[model samples]
Target: MIELRDAAYDYGGGGLALRGLDLSLAPGSFHFLTGPSGAGKTTLLKLLYGELRPTGGAALLFGSDTRAMDRDGVSDARRRIGVVHQDCRFLDHLPVHDNVALPLRVAGGDVASRADDVAQLLGWVGLGARMHARPPELSGGERQRAALARALVMDPDVLIADEPTGNVDWDMSQRLLTLLAELNRMGKAVIVATHDLALIRAAKAQVAARVLRLSGGALSAAGADL
Candidate 1:
């Protein structure tokens, strides 16, 4: 459902983040993007979700060229893809339940309409008790879970995460990976970008995950194993 053909990105004439990178993500596939710091992992994810257009080459998402899409079109396209960011930002004044339900709310779906479903989803992510708590009151792990819940609220066809496990402990990281694996089994394409090799290794044990390492302005596959 996603393809990048000979993609290259240049930020303000700086070093190229990706050069002549070719990648395709089929439905229900699971992938882990790994690299050292400043290896362009985040840049790749941004291109995938249409946050940044490629400077050279082509990127197709759901068969539409990202470069040709208008702002509203890009936003609509993103609705089909969910994203969990490393820094989960939320409205501090809103309760956790409201914050987690913001996606549906902003999309014109009634928040009150899906209240029970939101509660259930938050519970699944181990954030049931924090529903009434504000975002500022949540711990790092709790905030991460809330962000995951928000991302999945739309039942997106694809899920992309950047450094999802960066702020969590090892045990929490395992829990998050477990949840993502289950989502992949349910047919959502999953892609995670992380610098944590151990977490990538653990995810490999649970799913058929291909490790793609970005380095020196190019994207290439790592070894066959995790």
Candidate 2:
């Protein structure tokens, strides 16, 4: 559902993020993006989610060229994709339920009608009792799940998570991975960008994962070990 052809992103002032990167992700496919710091993993994820347009070449989402898409077009395209960032931020004053439902609210949906649905989603991510709590009150893992719940709240066609397991412990990480695996099984394409090889290994054991490593502003299939 996503493709990048000869994509190059220049950060300006002698820095380039991506260079001639050619990548494609099939619908319902599960993949891991791995690389060292500043290797363009996050840049690549931004490209997929329409947060960044390639400086050269084409970056396509579900057949729509990102460079050619207008603001409304980009927003519409992003509605089909969900992203979990490394540092998930939420309004500290808002309750967890409200924070998770912010996207729907921003999209001008009927909040009352979607209240129960958002609550159930919070419960799914193990935040049922914490629904009334503010974001600052949540623990690290709780915040992570809250972010995941928020991402899935849109029921997106494609899920892109950047360093999802970064803040959680091993067991919690496994639980989050399992949840993502289940989503992939349910036919939602998932792309995760992470530096943890162990997490990738764990995920690969549960699903047929296609792993890619970004290096020197380029992307390629990861070797067997990673």
Candidate 3:
């Protein structure tokens, strides 16, 4: 679990990207983070995952203050959290299966022993047939799904997705949402940062999520209008 208590972050000359934020992500919790351009959603996500420690307040991951964590501490905490970045950062030279297996490999996991799990995860994301395709050969939706598969291959306790459905069509967006919802049902905490209101509404029928809005370097609960 992660908790931020009056967390604030400033990027030197970039001014304050986030400030006075308090958030607690417990087991089985689901949250949707929404905001406009330059609103610091990505910065907040980075803080949550321990990529950036808060400059003025506490940002804790798995019970330890991120500011106090060493590199190995950060890596250990990150291994428990899976993040699907906005750009779907994949190595074009690697096939989808290998790309999905990269995290396990980096974590010193037995890739050979988990081959079947990797295949099953790709299939779950609807990319079974495209497992051998390289990143450059995939469609936008396919790439997103593949990214999700990669994020999940580690079986992390939390999943954080940034604009996960931004490049896909409505149907594909729904498909991805359904997959996320299923994961939530299985007890993983889910945090999705998206600007898509319709997608948020659609998620209403599938899972219980607290919608949050970030603006002017602060965070607030979204109104019922969402």
Clashes of 1: 0
For candidate 1, give the lDDT. Answer: 0.90
7-27, model 1: which lDDT tens digit per residue?
Answer: 999886666557898988788
TM-score, model 1 to reference: 0.96
- Cα lDDT listed for each candidate: 0.90, 0.88, 0.94
Instruction: Give me the overall lDDT of model 2.
Output: 0.88
Candidate 1: 10-residue stretch with minimal lDDT:
10-19
Q: If candidate 2 were superposed on the true structure by all CA atoms, what would the RMSD be?
A: 1.1
Model 2 misplaced stretches (Cα beyond 4 Å)? none
lDDT of 3 by residue, 37-122 (tens): 78999999999999998998999999999999999999988988999988999999999999999999989999999999999999
Who wins the TM-score comparison? Answer: 3
Rank by lDDT, highest first.
Answer: 3, 1, 2
RMSD of each: 1.2, 1.1, 0.9
Model 1 spans with C-alpha error above 4 angstroms: none
Please give each candidate's TM-score.
0.96, 0.96, 0.98
Q: Which candidate comes out best when scored by lDDT? A: 3
